[model samples]
Target: MSKVLQFACHFFAVCVSSNTPTAVYLGIMKHNGVPVDADLMKSRQQEAEQQMQRIRNEIIMLIGDVEIGANCGTKAFEDYLYQTLKLPVMKVTASNKEAADDASMIMLKEWCDANRPELSSLFTLVQECRKWSKIKSTYIDGYLKYLNSATGRIHPDFFALSTETGRMNCKTPKAQNLPRKSNDPIRVRNFIKAPEDHLILSLDFSQIELRVGAFYCRDRTMMETYKNGGDIHAATTSVIFSCTYEEAQDKHRKEYKEQRTIVKNVNFGTFYGLFPKGLQSTLKFKAGVEKSVDECEAIIRNLKSGYSALTTWQEETKRDAAGKMYIETWLGRRRYLSNIRSENWGLKSFAERCALNTPIQVTAADILKLAIVRILEGLPSRPWLKPILQIHDELTFIIPKEKLNEAVIFIRECMEQQPFPEFDLPLVAEASAGESFGNLEELEG
Candidate 1:
């Protein structure tokens, strides 16, 4: 057997090329897998085809498994699930009485609750299906009546979140919420099933936002809280209030929530040039304590002081972006921000948002991708654990009824020391393994 020639460990750089439409696609692919020169990729059609093939090969190698290929991309995945799950497809007849037949809107609830098994995705979706079915059908019909019929199936077209952005969201078999956001037992998740012999493994980080917050802040004081195993929001409260971490704890945690929300608000405001009026209208002030102008200014100062790295990040990236439309993440993910240069005020605000959000969002995405790759390789030859789903930063893997401790320890180890070498300050990964995603987060009574 021949060894697979693999490439890993890439440091990102700002690549500048003459403005052209197709050149950018080649540049991105070059970043992900093959290092195809944009000029060369665009220069020849045959070379471009070969480059794409190389991309396919690299992704397969990177993931270290073939199950992902079973339902390749979105369309392929939708087809596989719809056929395999055989979710009921029904439309309301707009009549006072419900009619039964092939044309009847597939009773999503019935299919999910009865037909679905003990899978995380299935459990989540089934509940949503039931809710949608229970809702007055009159509302559903009225909403759909105004729309065109070109939308053939509900699942594929319904799952789509946004057309402009590549990001797509999904409602369950019943048109409810996106799969990740839905908290049903039988709707969207019912579509996902475990292999007869294999178990599904699920792993998610606790307070990932806090961890990222500490990383970007670079505040020795703030970083020390995370390292010392103190609650992050509470720690922030302590720092702001000059109180102990224990003293900072509150039932409502209003003070802590305010600090955290301030950090986010100012982090957002830095790019958008937040207005004072907009600043006061946040969820943080739901109790009717309007953030005064002085308070908003203080929040901005504290935020800049906190995420010093991001301040530098914005300045450097904007300098790098210039008039261009994109900025790259830590792992070379380039998010376009051309709107920054737009004459329209709305677009300009969004462009600024992209500037702030691109790095954090893309860097988070990169970290997730790297973690997944390493986890795949780190699995033991006959490891009982198996990868099931990668919904955002959370990874759901099935575990055996026995080997729970071992699996939890191993899953923790995978994220802690991953992507080779060592991570400074120790990349702490807080995890809980259990029967289900919801169950994993639960504290024993």
Candidate 2:
């Protein structure tokens, strides 16, 4: 065989052998499809449609009978925002036309909040209309279309090796992409109903990615924060804002709340070698906190200074990837970055960012997969615990209502076990339970 073909075969063999346990676990989850409350789903669909119509009418009244499509993606709507309403365009498609995507809407809303308070109501109506339309069509109608006639549940297919980072991808109804309670105004997750004598329990790894990043970077501040069970975001806020930890933890004060929110976003983005412009845009568009590029640079500088090991690790990682043309997770799963040596600045920079991101993210993915294998091994003793879904770092299951305490302890133990011998920091899995997926309340030990 050609060298390339031989390498490909070896790679596939390694991946298949390493991931067999996770594949088996996912098969079991697929067999036990997620239960749905058909009646509740139908009601939600009707309510969402009504809300969409009301918002559409309100938008039409404001914008003077413009034809607004269900998703507000029409050219006329774009023209209204840029031409008639005169909102500044924040982003554009690859074709270079004025953008009206969700990010654009968020930026336009922020602009209205600052510059045109009188017109803020128009964007609010547009955003709400789009949200209701998505919830209705994507969640309600989408789920109904895929509902199995015989089983009465939506059986989403999971692909274990599809993603480059080793995370499983869900399709058909895309159950993994369901909006969380904070974002789901209509509570679409409530459609994931447990049986009368059962409850939906979720055990989510608490900030698994950050913990993995800390392990990779060996940053003293980050490792110490996790070790002490302190709030990493608050520690980051203290570092960036130059305030006492107590001051940063003061959420009641408006200034501190805004600062902490910005700091949290910065901390999440920093691991991927976030540029100042990117950080500024992320804070404004995603976090709703307007920050100048210079301010963002200062925050990043503070972060690097406070966590000195992070920059050292990032530099060393990039240098190694450039030299070897590949990066690997801590568990030795390799991702080849052919463009690391490219002459083009864009490709080289992207490869560098991937080099920094893949190790930490893929390592976290490995840890989650290991936890799944552990759960699978213990499943025979606890057949009442039916694993239904794996969403990122969280595992959702159905258990008898009477078995809540026992199941929580079992699942938490599975998820919290040391992923590998070298992973010195502690791993935490938080438990929550409820009658429906949307209404879960955190279970205290």
Candidate 3:
């Protein structure tokens, strides 16, 4: 290729490959429109649509031979469906009235209910079909149809200030909202691949929210547990049940495992300011632990008593929000609490919880963004590396296979660098590498 043609091709390749915002690139280059590699984009779109159709057919087959009114359409069908799916009849009845045409994750999960273990495969198939169908239709097909016909690529517009938290939002293709890694047949991520001799390396923070929570509260037990590189959930379970980690895993292992799960839920929910009723429903449906509101209250009490500093911090944060009507992250990112002092109990409670949770979550978001910027800054120095995508806490890069070792170290170091030292806790990032985005394996440090 001629020098000018080669540079143009290289620039286009980088724009597509580096997760560069299309509008930003176009504006910088003074280009009126963006180009897409139509042939390549079309081939991938077709493959995804074909796979989605296959799954759709299988879903139909799995439902098998049920009469419309007998097993599908009528009230009798609803009853039979609940019985077969093992969903709580009352909940199904209620939600059916709520969203008779809906098939959301929460709804499907409710339908899966107590028989999760036995019906997990069925549930996976059902959900995968639904999720993949939407992705194929809304993203792949939509992107193909909407691609800049002249340029042959989709240039999704990204709005940095769209979210309540400081997270970037993408429209057109909604690139940020794509499905996560799943074991099911829907491999939408597979379409995202590295160029020849390059691999996609994903590095994600491990248990960042919990770590941030511990650091914020300065809860001695939590800090000690995290600092020692111990299992925080198991540690909390031990505290709640008065047993060692070993004992929790050894004697009555299954029961202790369930206990650990309860602790895990409490750990997550405490940050969200979940009430006993919320805990009770989550425990009953998600954890498969049938607990009454009173039992859930006891668990909440145990969590609070065990992590007194964290509980106190939560209450203090809420009080501060009620008074000042705002909360800020460690790095000075402010989330104004407009409804924190509302007279309506529900609105006030929601605002209070958001105030408590936003700081920790936004801190994590800030860290991730800083890490991305740092990674970008470091990339030019390493010629073989190009960052292709970032989803949530994970950053995906395209790097030569030979540079994997150095790349892993560099990425994790960038990711784990703490911008604010006073709020110190060891930040851990897990990594993986693969030629395709869908099949990354753990990169053990």
Candidate 4:
């Protein structure tokens, strides 16, 4: 690529990190005459994910189904896919040498050739997919590195105020408001701080979803796993598939999407309702209606057996939510689910989603708020540590090398030991000290 193109691509990646769809849309509109059918075009973006999955399945099925008495041309094709589309998120085929496991290379070439006019768009989309699957975590690392830099100190341009909402807003990279890492880095995160010696202590739960499931469902098994820092997803898998914990763990080994979907089905099913077909789809119901249907029933039966509380909670929550026609955080952050009572089917569905999501999200968000306040007040003894940034569950701080350990312990205490109902559930944390604040992978040893 030309220097200009390279620079523009880099710039575009930065824009994606900002996570503002408007700016992205405007940029696209400026470069191209506003491609029509934007909604359709946007939805077709699903094609990227579906296409990737399809290509992957084709390759996997080929390897599993082919009557390979001898490995011939097929091996070469598998090798090509491995090297070309090195998706870190995906599991690689066992053959590392001159053999390709799947037909991704051919599929990719076909996809690219068929969408030549929109190759740039596809490339952008694919890059984004890879980031979520690959690089976004690194971006988080890099952000932490900057926040921890020796010379780095608090910058005044960090926070802003909205005249419209009369709320404090974050400016610049909007550290306080950086977009969730998705298709692009979105933008630079906005953070505030005292100085290098000062640090921000951040703590979040290791298995919050499990805790939520435990609390909402009153499931002893879920609660106990979280209590002991055991693998909740694997446990769920064990029950749903009627397998041992080891087998459940094996199923999840390289099948994260499948594992995640199944876990989510059971998790959310307790909160809502997981009919068989729905569970199957969540559990990666690919191509086979009968299989998915069968799998879902098994999933439901297992979930009900293990965590019937969730099923009851889901119904109770639904009834409570629907009747209220809205929900609120513990601190009264209300989400008006007017659609729960709406005449429109689409709006009602959206409202129901909001209704279900509102309590869980709002509760978690409030917990974050309470933790922040506690950390700020409790950390005065270690003035070397100052709050630099807050990104959902993660917080950033810049600290002198000497004070980091002490500061971290104190922060963890404040962050993790909030007085929720299940205080003895055993809070688990995964923390790493770092030199700077840019990428998480670069955390201090």
lDDT by residue (1-445, candidate 3, tens digit) is 8966875776566334332442342232222222333555567667766766676565457656443221123444344456565454344334355222224334555545654654444445555555555666765676676676654445556443456776655566665566645432445566556667877788988888889889889999999988888888877787677778777666467686678778888777778887999998788656767788988888788778888998899989899878889887776556888989899998999898899788888777667766665676675588776554556777666678899999999989988888566866788899999887667888788
Judging by lDDT, tell me the better candidate of 3 and 4. Answer: 3
Instruction: Point out where model 2 deviates above 4 Å.
Output: 1-17, 80-88, 109-119, 250-254
Clashes found in each candidate (C-alpha, N, C closer than 3 A): 27, 0, 5, 43
Clashes of 2: 0
TM-score against native, each model: 0.51, 0.92, 0.73, 0.54
Best by TM-score: 2
lDDT of each: 0.44, 0.88, 0.68, 0.48
Candidate 3 segments exceeding 4 Å error: 1-97, 101-129, 142-156, 180-183, 249-252, 283-290
Query: Which window of 10 residues has the lowest lDDT sum in candidate 2?
Result: 10-19
Q: What is the Cα-based TM-score of model 3?
A: 0.73
lDDT of predicted model 1: 0.44
Q: Judge candidate 3 at residue 29 and give its lDDT.
A: 21
